[model samples]
Target: MKKIILSLIVFGATISLASAQILPAFQIGLKAGTNLSSLNSTASETFSGSNRAGYLVGVWTRFGAVGFNFQPEMYLTSKNVDVTSSSGGVTRAKFTSIDVPLLFGGKFGALGLGGRFYTGPVVSFAIDKNQSFDSAAGKVFSLNYQDQNFAWQFGTGLDIKRISVDLRYEAGITKQTYDGRQTRISLFNLSLAYSLVKL
Candidate 1:
């Protein structure tokens, strides 16, 4: 009987210690942002495009340990390009894609309220209604774009209370053909994120 009582006491103590030590180092959040997007050419063909504005809205989860964290996010994003042809005609093409990024990073200064930096590869899947093209020559064309593409992202953010403000740049790693011309896309993103839960 005495051994049984002692064992119960030890178990209770262990449970209490675990509860005290294992606090929530994970956060879940929502983010919205804007993108300044453009295109570049690597082939012999010359491509000219103006910077276009796009939007992003997403959900993200981050797991942190010892001032470092891994963040993975999914978003509905807009990507676009506006090109001027040699005949002084302009074509505006827009794309919609689901973007997924897994970022590994470190935080500095304060634990929950500080600055962070991350770099990661992102993959995007094109959705239906992916492309809309309009030209100044009264021509409208819609083509099924490439289904998937990859990019590299570098970003920095500042966390204040439950809000984070971030700036990021993404560069394309593969060539995607647009209107029979080989080109790649890149963008600058500015975002604001809010923490919804931490447990």
Candidate 2:
């Protein structure tokens, strides 16, 4: 009887301690941001990439304890870039996709203000009407965009009450083929998020 009572007490204490550590079990928020996107050639024909402004709007959710959490987000985004070659060939690209990112990160600080850092895999499914674009005149190179883009994102953020700001860098892990040449994409993202529900 005493052993059973002790076990019950221990279990209750553990639960209480865990609950105490978790300020809120979950949070849902809306975030909107702009990104500067660029592309790089990974083939024998070297080309320079130029950045263009792209935008994203999404909803995100975070769960687990405050110190460490899992964050997942879904967003509609545009990634655009311009490429220029030494021979004065210019190509412009606009890609729109639905993106989902699964991120794991941690937070530190106290008194309702903290800093966060996260790294994750973000997958993008293209929704653009056109998947391929014409090459510049006299230039055999062209962009053949894939239906799915796989990338990684890592960044840091600051939280003040219900509003947070994040700055992140994203790089493609897959290639977007251009004729016989291949290219990669990269972006820098800045976003503002507001928590609609925090519990």
Candidate 3:
């Protein structure tokens, strides 16, 4: 925890020093959104849909030009899965992760339209995991789910002045479960952000 804070401090200092001489093409923002998440695996299951509420708060920096930019962010995400059985109603499985993403974007502006296409990598660390099931006999299964993995993201956004709205899709490139099972997590996120400070 201390190390993470120190690293962020160092990163902020580095960015500050680097922007001192440049044209000051940097901005910071906060983001919040929902996540449509699920696991793609070979395990036998009877689940139909799994959508959950997730949010993120972080600072972002954008370099010059509407053509290319790099944005890095840190956020806390909540992911949940809903399962149903033949005789039962529904079950819920929830997981939380701390994620850091580094993204690159391309922007286009014309005809009163402005938007950007962005894609990048994300690293996540799981904080909690649990499952609940509703069955004929109220059957339940619980396992210590691991959620440390690297993920790839692709998305687009609209940028207007100090505010931006983005939609992104994320797919895990590495497995998260500890049982050597081929399981992957994916997220569809919508975020709104405001520029905290501009340089």
Candidate 4:
């Protein structure tokens, strides 16, 4: 038991030492990922909502010390959701928007690896100039897309050299309207990013 404990301590010390050796002051990267989204609502008038897959592509920049940093990201997001009304009517919404998230987080590392936990507000702007949905004409509720929306995100990330991965959960701070019925969007987003510039 003593030998095992000593070995573990030695390994941890080595990792911590390596981590302190390589702390970058700044970095920039590009990322792409997929998301699963569901509609959340407490309104009695609403029916059911199911999850749907979506896509996100974007770029990110990070700055500060090794233990604490400020990260900002901009991405183009495509979201899809399927909602069923009480009257058995269904609507499929596929919307595209531009998202900007300003994140503040702390990071820790071992050896050549690191982890980060972050929280931030994400502001989304609608870019559905062509139309938010392909068809909502037949649904029981008429769909109307919002021009802008706000949400909060909490997530963790991993960093290995120049590569990083992030998993985040987002919940709406305000309700969005579709057919005049208000609902919140809740989603899980997973992304892979590569740093192009690290200083």
Give each model's clash number: 0, 0, 1, 1
Write the residue-wise lDDT of candidate 3 on 1-199 in tens digits.
Answer: 9999999999998766554322336777777777788766665453244566666665567775435678888888887876544334566778788889999876666432568888899988888776776665444333335667789999999978777899999997776442333466677888888888766
| TM values, all candidates | 0.79, 0.82, 0.72, 0.82
Deviating ranges (above 4 Å) for candidate 4: 1-24, 129-139
In model 1, state the lDDT of residue 22. Answer: 35
lDDT of 4 by residue, 1-199 (tens): 9999999999998777556533557899999999998888776466667799999999999986647889999999988887777666777777789999999998887554989999999999989733332234344554455779899999999999899999999997767765567888878999999999988
Q: How much lDDT does candidate 4 score?
A: 0.83
lDDT, candidate 1, equals 0.79
lDDT of each structure?
Answer: 0.79, 0.83, 0.71, 0.83
Query: Per-residue CA lDDT of candidate 1, range 1-199, in tens?
Result: 9999999999998766444323338899999999998877653244467898999999999887666788999999998777655444566778889999989887765445788999999999988444444455544433225779899999999999789998999998767764567777899999999999976
Q: Per-residue lDDT tens digits of candidate 2, residues 53-111?
A: 99999999988684788999999999988766545566677889999999999887666
Off by over 4 Å in 3: 1-24, 43-49, 84-91, 110-113, 135-140, 176-181
**Model 3 residue 120 lDDT?**
91
Error of 3 at 175 (Å): 2.3
lDDT at position 135, candidate 1: 59
RMSD of each: 7.8, 5.2, 12.5, 5.5
